[model samples]
Target chain A: MHRRRFVTLCGGSVAMLAAGLRGVRAEPFVDFPKVRLVDAAGAPLKAAALATNDAYVFHYPLRSFPCFLINLRKPAGEPREMTSEALAYTWPGAVGTQKNIVSYSAVCTHELSYPSKEGSEIRYAAEASPLSGKPGMIVCCAHDSIFDPAAGAPRLHGEARDPLLPVRLEYDPAEDAIYATGLAGTWLLDRFLKSYRRQLIAEYGAGVYKEPVGATSAAVLLNTYSGGAVSTC
Target chain B: MSECINRRDFLKMGGAAVVGGAAVTAGCASAGPAAVSAGFKAALPRAKGPRLVIVGGGTSGLTIAKHAKKEYPKFDIVLVEKRDMYSSCFSSNLWYAGLINLEFLADHSFLDAARNNHYIYFNATATGLDRAGRKLITSEGEIDYDFLVVAPGISYDYNRIGVKDEDTIDALRTGYPGGFISPTEHVTIRRKVQEFEGGLFLQYVPNGNYRCLPGPYERACMIASHIKKNKLKGKVLVLDANPEITIKKDGFHAAFKELYNGIVEYKPGSAITGVDLAKKTVKTEFDSYRFEDASIYPGVRASTLIEHLGLMDAKSPQKEALISQLKYNYIGDERVYVTGDSRPHPYSKSANTANTEGRYVAKVLAARAQGKDITWYSPRTVCYSMVNANPPEAISVDAGYVLNKEGTAVGGFSPDTKLFEKRDAAKGRGTLEWARGMYRAMFEG
Candidate 1:
């Protein structure tokens, strides 16, 4: 038993005596039923899913890459075991832009972990510069993190520049959920710095080096270095 | 920076914008006639030469500097580090168990290591790198590095794991994210662990590859051992990042069950989606849960430095490894080498591996300095994974020289459970001895 489930189970029992006298909501502890670790096809099930499909897209505009936007048209009453081979979405519905629904690999081209969504902006774990075939530029906020969406560069920046391996996902007809099958090799994309370098030049312009005005404008473009300066409009 | 922001704020925001690859609106708020700090400007170093700068003072950069000095005695090796004192994360668990003190784990300066080897050491931050000029531009002045090796250790994606924001990094008083970075966070987390009496000490692991594959389990053992020894009323809930774990489950189970028994609870296959700080609530894909002290380990990526340098290779096992220039790689630029925990090596992110890689990279450069067709030292890694609380189990693997082809070398790992061995009596002690030597090799200087 994971420690949380055990605590929830124990917490439930601790509150059981009180419930006998009067109906009550348990302390809302972690309740993990002893579900199988994986499904028959050997895939992981969702430990938690949103109650509604609208929850798929996060509202925070500042979210970084590798952060997930979980949504479900309908969800199960409890967290259940999921199989790796579970179907995600049927072809017709999942293809938001294309004809069929294709799975996307959330792992950054940099390291394999999901991108860390900072300040609501999901910063790409790797640079988002396009590699060759992958689309979408997921930029990591901290470093030279930029990934090109048009061509997912296997390795975004720094070292690891492999394609963002895709996940074999399909749309579920019954639940309207996107399920994953196996790991898909990542698509290649163009590098991300072209646009990144452009942004700084465009935003700050040539006037950035002047006394208070230039420094202020440049700072606006570079917060960590600028110290969050206010513009003198 | 917009109409509402100031000059300083604009610069900070602009830097962030440039970093994020966002169309930064460098629009500044009209703060009238601001004066730039002369002191800040004057602090810049007044030296000029082919300067080599390293940001991190931890295992990776420090080790590289040691060898780099031996190779280039004349080149100015400038080490810009943030931390004054360094502690061994490799042996940090012992501190939690009251086996060691901060002093015993404290790291030494490169001054000793670089004796006769002239290098400037500064406590500053490197903002950007101009690879073409081989320059490391810091808040101070630009220090040109013919060779730049970046190994800034694990910088968390706190907000991604639902910590809220970077500022909140200071707000959280408990969990693993607490002290993983600076010593302050460590002190804060220690207090939370001390204050808590019972309930569930839930440590949520995020999905996919993260820093230190077996870290959560090791931490769980440490936490559970402490709880059992102290006889706390609570059990430890380990919400794994994925089903099963990177470590051997059987051994992990045996250790936890034998030592912790009722004190630790293990949850496999659950991913932490979000965290509610105020309610101390952790929400997963399946359910909404609450905890007394929640330590959420969010998803990971290459360190900010690695990200900034644009050196990721998704296809390769060594995400942090610099592929050849045929791949237009950043490797061997002025013979630049990145090692230790910072690099996205395929092996378990253990100190053991970091130590091994540090030496391996050092050897490669040393051999290169000696003008020999070097290739004897390949990158290999071994990890001492703690199952319950007993010393730690060992998992070993290698690549390049052994696992892979391509006259190159790097770190590696495997899913095979047998790779992990139950440490025998003497072997366990031997592992500790190895860890001690590694720390000394890098830090004793």
Candidate 2:
């Protein structure tokens, strides 16, 4: 165990931190303002209330950046270091009482395919997917890249060479609420923004896509968010 | 008087003769006219690092030009492509059925791709290669390179279809184009599909490991869909040379039977023995069939550029380059290489294969440039075939190759290769996204 220090930057909208962990390398972390996850009806989402069968989608850090909040149904493994083309960081493991709650960027690390209102190429497969052939895996059918969210979202198969970017989460036992505090491998966020500038502008306003999701962000079921057009592969 | 003409003057005369008789002499020679240089280096900025010159800016060259820079930042890359505009050949079939439009295939720009990836996009046709001097001679000028990759893709072998004379070859080339190589052919095919009135519209499938094994079948389905939608009195006859549907057979067969039962007719073991252009009929060994319109896809060989550059393997039935199947370098020369459909590999000659293989070759170039080496890894081919355009359904295959028992070259599909032959709307959506992902990988940073 080592001391982790956070240095506030950009007027608390963003912070730089040095991740001090056993296996994880020291890297600059992009800490966004903590946003409480709420359901579609503006009610605070309880960590324990989340269904283990399917994942939930939430906009965090920014209005356009989608993240997946999943309950593994079983305790997640120990904190592990993950590497991507963007950066290297430690997924601090699940944070619920049972240590079964985890979240990762919905963007496919392979080519940045993310969930939209119409459809999503990447989805959480609760059962064994034809592509992954394993339960509880995130499969990106765009190129058949599979990730195990229970174990730091490491890539298990296909063309992707990096693990899925992890989203940092904090649990409130008193309120039974969950908060997204920061994101690992934030460099990919810049890439996703640049690569999808036109589509994001159409989805969100011209520049509203990059606006920080101030205090609370709405979370919705993946099926509901993508209108049931999630690819199971 | 002839003796007084110096080698330079004689070469200039030869170049003029080639230009004058372009159509007649296009594919007749193994190489293009001798490299008549502009007598200067290409108008490019001085290389800040080791220059990597890649010819044929299709999927393979474009991918390598972008990725090689990422793998080794010290290497400067310049892509030499003949076409100023980029229209992909992979997803062109979707255009015939109006599932997608011309913009979908042609909207991608080479200038934008080069600017986004920090590479030079030199619009020039590669005419010859000076391997020893490390110079790639192009129509514009010569480019000096520390590393060179030629991924010119495939060319149609008219002789394979028994069309030996230049006149009939030209007639077939212009009248019923293959729709596999050029954007012009795609445009022509799209127009023919749109204007088709009735009768048999033949789609020929060539023999051997032709480019896009399932392309003709997919196109047949698209054309049949068009015919079905319009209630036209016609059928698309898929004259496949192979004994059966080459890939994703079950899906394509199901589409033919279930979706376009009356509109699409598939005939296997129907290799085109000869084409009588005047009669609009193609002859197999046992039978001759007449067609109202046809995309006469003859047998394919490596791009004539391979033979022009003298990198072709004489023993290769497809006239592919003589390169290491694993490393993609010339047999004896590491400075020069070939990839994409030009390489003598048994891999699928599709955009996905080229893109993945390009990334691997980029790593290989980076390692060799640094005086180091990396182990061989297989390139994955994730291909999607649209079987129905009415509701947009597709089948897909996710395949990875493995070396043979001898570990010498790519032998067959890996154990984990999976085929989704059950056509569904999900895979159909995946089909479009898959192509979009490929575009993002090649064109975006």
Q: Return the lDDT, model 1, position B437.
A: 47
Please provide TM-scores computed only on chain A for all of the candidate models, following their numbering: 0.29, 0.88
Taking the tens digit of each residue's C-alpha lDDT, what string does model 2 give over A101-163? 999999998988999998999999999888887799999999999999999999999888778
Q: For candidate 2, lDDT tens digit of each residue in B10-59?
A: 22222222232212212122433256454778888999899999998899
Q: What does candidate 1's lDDT look like per residue over B32-113, in tens digits?
A: 1122221233143554544456667776677666545544443456777766566666656555655456765664455654
Candidate 1 lDDT, A46-72, residue by residue in tens: 323322211121111011112122222
| Least well predicted 10-residue stretch by lDDT in candidate 1 chain B | B23-32
Best candidate, DockQ-wise? 2
Indicate the worst ten consecutive residues by lDDT in candidate 2 chain A: A13-22
